[model samples]
Target: MQHNLGVIGLGHWFGWLEKGVGEKGSLKLVKAVGTKPFEDKAKLLTGFGITKDRYYISDPDGKIPEEFFEGLDLVHISDPNKFHKAQAIESLEYGKRVIVEKTLAINEREFEEMKSFLKKKGMEDRIYLHLHYLHKQPTLALAREMPGLVAKYGKITSIEANFFEPVNEEDPRRTWLLAPENGGIFMDWVHTSEIIFRMTKCSFGGIKKASDFGVNTDYDSVNPTGVETVVEVSGSSYENGALATMRMAKGTEKALANKTLRIVFKSGFSVFACFPGHEAEFNNAGARGTLKILDAKGKEISSESLSGQNSSEIFISEILDFCDGKRVGLNLDEITEIFKSQWEYQRTAGTRRLITDRESIDAFLRNGASYTYCK
Candidate 1:
């Protein structure tokens, strides 16, 4: 059975979310809930989309009445951080699976409370997270192939990486990047999923760890000040003003290309085999073997290339997977746990309330405590 979805927050990225997700490809919109009442509801979302059945809520505290979520299967929440935990908890209680926006909550304290609420209601399993595109996160994509990639060459001795991109000057200017209660950069980046890749997925050997100061959002503001944060995870550091470095062999395709990358882990030696001046498009995503110890000296290691389905599609394919019998590996409990640990790390390092704070979500988390992967 296709899941009937109710897209609550219809904002700029609403279109992107509709296009890039679940059963929406075939199911009905079921309902659309926005912050405004039916009148302004349609107005705020003008020009984008507003189906007939989709209604609006004028007062910020309005609800769909009793049993409003009776038949809905899923609810995607893209509201501001301040309203997320509350709205999401309600949706889950009403029996709607949830995919909340980043940070999950304004503070770490709420992160715990919301999920705990669901666990107590026997709805924790139904509560899910749907986050937007995570920037600069190709790190784990590389790690997935580590086992096979390393087998042919040699054990990975050392790895290095540097990830940095200027804030979308235009996008943030129009969104939440400006508010502190909305959880400035630290809340969005450090306390959320972006850092999950660093915590559990990537494998690197770096000695120093550091975090950079957060830059003022009103960069164009006259006496601007920014938050400076330093955190060490997975052997790497974060520096705001300086270039990041990961000391692994530049021997792979996804590793740093522009900066210095030298990988010398038993595979003779490989230096960004896909560097622009070298191989082009096909060579772009797949790993390249610079020097493998497989054949005799002077023998160039063969370049491997392949592509097909993405994991998101695979993850989604498992949706009705639970309909009949449970399938293995279709779920991401371990992956989610790895991600939760990073959230805990962020809560400890920065001043914020975590998901563990909410009494309800705290119970929600306990249920998962034993569902870890067997591998």
Candidate 2:
């Protein structure tokens, strides 16, 4: 009953190690492919049940060796966004299930190609996106309440969601994240967009007033080497006729750190969710801060404190369910629509200078931006 797994990237080894690795767990890592040397990754791979002989360096041409997929029941592709389409389609050709990281492709064309291939093979359920944020406690709680809230208070009317993480100069992700081929800050919003979709079950309508900082002052330079250190976008949703605004940024200071979602209903009822890292202080344990129901007068109706949980632990459990043909994650059509919205924003969004100085920072704060929990 063991499901053999092969990994296409090593950036997440530390997190993946926590997933049950051997006979005690359902997933067994049979092969590992990465850009790093075998010696550097062998110890970590061994911990994940990958034998030394099974570790292979990816080809310089970026082609996955055909033999690597010979025995894998599924492949976990955590490579950069630009590499997802080729790797995913290739894995599917070998009849292995695929779990890819978010921002599934760098552009709409690539996203659609993956979808078309899946349909042609009739393996639509064989691929899943590793949008781990969806597994966070507050998100799960909000998802549970969405149905009842809509039935009682009517459809959602407005939404404001943002995720800001401090940029670590030494962080390895910064390199590729800034690469033009990977689709810049616009691609990073896939997580935020998917969250909006899941919570409201609405398709993104189109981009309106989208902008990014840190790339360039030239508004036409939507795809550039200097990816957005900060991005903010507002748009509409199809089904519920809601105005949704989302912001995502990696800032150099703690002043820009937060993760929250606010949903307002037609009846003046709202749900405010403080996700992990809502505070400037980050923690290892993924304790989602709180979920509060607020009235139009801003009085708290009910609040739930979600306990600390490991994200990887939740991901592995849900992904296993996905491997069993369960529809626990976003479907291909939803992914296609999300990417379409991203493309529209990229083509139309204006580029602004990076917000680094005190004057700009103060101006940003004064523009009615608040990250604190419902008070």
Best by TM-score, which number? 2
lDDT per model vs. reference? 0.41, 0.66
Q: For residues 111-157, could you state the per-residue lDDT of candidate 2 as single tens digits?
A: 66777778898988888887756777777777777888877776777
Q: Mind giving the per-residue lDDT tens digits that candidate 1 earns over 69-173?
A: 657776767766667777777776675666666545766567667646655776645555544222212323334444555565554343333222233334344
Cα deviation in Å at residue 353, candidate 2? 7.3
Please report, as a residue range, the 10-residue window in candidate 2 with the lowest summed lDDT: 225-234
Instruction: Tell me each candidate's TM-score.
Output: 0.57, 0.83
For model 1, what is the alpha-carbon lDDT of residue 57?
54
